[model samples]
Target: MTGAADLLSRLVEEVNPSSAWRDSFIRIPRHRFIPDRIWVEDGDDLAVLDRVDDPDAWLRSCYADRPVVTQVDDGDTTGRGYRSSSASMPSIVAMMLDATDLAAGQRVLEIGTGTGWNAALLADRVGAGNVTSVEIDPAVAAQAEEALGGFGVHVVLGDGEKGYPPGAPYDRVLATAAVQHVPYPWVEQTRTGGRIVTPWGTSFHNGTLLRLRVGEDGTASGRFGGNAGFMWVRGQRTPHGTLDGRVRPDHEYAETSTDLHPYEPVGDFEATFAIGLRVPGMKDLVVFDGDVPGNPHYTVYLMDPGSGSWASWRIRPGPRDYRVRQHGPRRLFDELAGAYTWWQEAGRPAHSRFGVTVTCRGQRVWLDDPGNPVSPEDPV
Candidate 1:
C-alpha cells in the first residue's frame, strides 16, 4: 500500500515546495481529503473510479501528482462530463502556495475550497483558526467542512467571487479556481500590503498564475507567471460545444487560403496566451483525420459562440498554405492572424512579461508595465 510518506517524497522530488510547507505535506495525508468516488477522463467523457471496487488504483491515484476530478456537471450524474471540481495538481498547488509568501499567525482567505486539502495546508502553515475558506457548492462544502472539522479552520458555504466580508482584512487571499477577472471584493477584503494569488486566463487560453499585491488606494496589480492552467470559476466558464454541434456542412462561409500555419498561433504556449488577450471570446480545437493515431492531417477549428463566428484552418503534412474558412459576423481567423503578427512585432514577449492591473473601473492587461496596456489601438 502506498503511504503518505511516499507521496510526500514524490512531491519533494517533483515540486520541491519550500521548507515552510514541507512539514504540512508530510503530516497531512492527501487521500483522506479525496472522495471515495473520483472521476477520471475516458476519452471525451469521465468515468467513475470507486475506492471500494479498486482500492489499490484509488490509493495510487490519490498519491499521483496530477489532479483528480472530484465532481462533474455540478454533481449531476445524468449531465455531460464537465469537470466541475478537482483536487488541483500537487505541483500547481505547491506553486500557488509558494507564490503566497505566507507566514505563521497571518489570516488567510481561501476561495474555491474544493476538497479542503489546500485549506488544510494553509491552516498548517498559519494557525488553523487564522484560515477561512469559502466554497460555493453545497455538497463540496459539506465534505470539506467534515474533513476540516478537527482542524479548526472556518469553512463558509457561499459564492467565492463576493468573498467573505466577515473575514475582511485578511493577510492573504488564495483562489484555487481560475478567473478571467480579479473580483474587486478580494482586493477590498485583503490588507493594503497583502497578496492575492489565483489562476487568470482568457477564452482562448486556460492560463497562468497571477500574484497581485493590494495597494492602499484599493486596487491590486501583478504579473502572470508559471504554466498553471486550472478549471475556470463556474460563473466565468466559456461556453462548451463540440465541433459537430458548432460547424456544419450547410453553413455558408467565405473561403480563403493563408501561408501562415497554426504552428505558433495555436500550438505555441506564449503565442496563444498573448493572442487570447488580444482576441476575446475565441476557442480553438484540433481534430485529426479519421481519428487515427500519428495522422499529420488535421483541422484546427476556431469558434466564437457568442457572435456565431467560426473559422476552420486545414493542415496537411506537406503544404505551407492552409485552406481557411470563416462564417458569421466576426473574422476569427483574421483576428487571430493579426494578434499573432502583433505579438511578433512586439518582440514576442513571454506570457510572464504580461501583467494585470485591477481598479474600480475593472481590469486591464498590460505589457511590460501597467501604463502600456495591451489593446487593439496600441501595437506594443
Candidate 2:
C-alpha cells in the first residue's frame, strides 16, 4: 500500500502546481475530508456508496482533484432524485486557490466548509489559527469542525450569507457556494483592500470565479476568472412555490427575439460567451438531449428565478423571429439577451474585465465593469 501520503503527492503532481501550492496540496490529505459513505450518481438521482464497496474508486476520487458529491440534500431525500449538494470538483478548487493567492499567516474565510479539505489546505498554509470556515448545515459544520479540530481552524454553523462577522476584516474570503449576488456580509467581513473570490453567476453550471477587492466604502469590484459550478447557498434558493403550469411538453409555443443583437448564427448554444451573458447567474444551466444539431427538433432552456421566468428556445432554421412563451416577473431570455448586448457593446471582454458587488441586501451577482448601481429597477 502506497498510503494516503503517497496518494496526496501523486495528486499534487497530476494536478500541476507551483512549488508553494504543490507543497500545500500534499500537506492536506483529501481522504480525511470525506466520509465513510458519500453521495454518487445513481441514474438520475444521487445515491450513497459505502466506501467499503469500492475503496479503490473512493481513493481515486478523493485524490483525483475532483470535488466528490458528499451528502445529497443532507442524506434525507432519496439519493435517486435531484442533487442538492456536493464536495465540488478538484480543478474548480484549484482555480479558487489560484485566485485566492493565500499566503502564510493570512486570515481567510471560507464560505462552504464542504468536507473541510479546502479548509485544511488553507490551514496548512495560513496556519489553522488564521483560517475560519462556515457551513450552513449544522451537521456538516459539526463534522468539519471535528475533522479539523486538531488544526484549530474555526468552522462555524450558520447561514453562509451572514458570514462570520466576528472574524471581522479578513484578508481573503473564499466562497465555494454559487451566489446569485455578492452578499453585503462578505464585503463587511472583509478588510478594506482585501480580496474576495467566489463562484459568481446566476445559474448553477454557468458561473465564473469572481475575484474582487473590497473598497473603503464596503463595495467590492473585480473581474471574472475561469468558469466553475457550485451548489446554490440555502438562503439563495428562490421560493419556487405555487407554480401555475409545468414545462409545456410540446414546447411549440416558445419563441426567440433579437431586437438588440445583430443576428449571427448560433453554435454550441451551451458554450457561447454570448449565451452565458444572456443566461447569467441562472441557478441551473444544462444541455438536454431531445434534438441534435441538423435535426428536425432542437431546443435548450434558459431559466431565471428572480423574475420567475423561463425561456425555451430551439433552432428550426425557419425564421429569425419566433414567438416566445413568457412566464413569471421577468421573461428570462429577454434578460439574457439584454445582458448579452450590454456585454457586446462593451467590446465583448472576458469575465476578468467584469467586476462584482455585494450589495447591502446580500445579493452576490456578477455585473459588467463600470458597474450598475442598485437602482429601483435593477438592484445589485
In order, what lDDT does every prediction score? 0.90, 0.67
Candidate 1: stretches off by over 4 Å: 376-380
Over all chains combined, what TM-score does candidate 2 have? 0.80
Q: Backbone clash tally for model 2? A: 25
Candidate 1 C-alpha lDDT tens digits along 270-328:
99999999999899988889987547899999999898889999999775989999999
Best-fitting candidate, scored by lDDT: 1
- How large is the C-alpha RMSD of every model relative to the true structure? 2.3, 4.4
Q: Provide the global lDDT of candidate 1 against the true structure.
A: 0.90
Worst 10 residues of 1 by lDDT: 371-380
* lDDT minimum window of 10 residues, candidate 2: 261-270
Error of 2 at 264 (Å): 8.8
In candidate 1 the C-alpha lDDT for residue 23 amounts to: 82
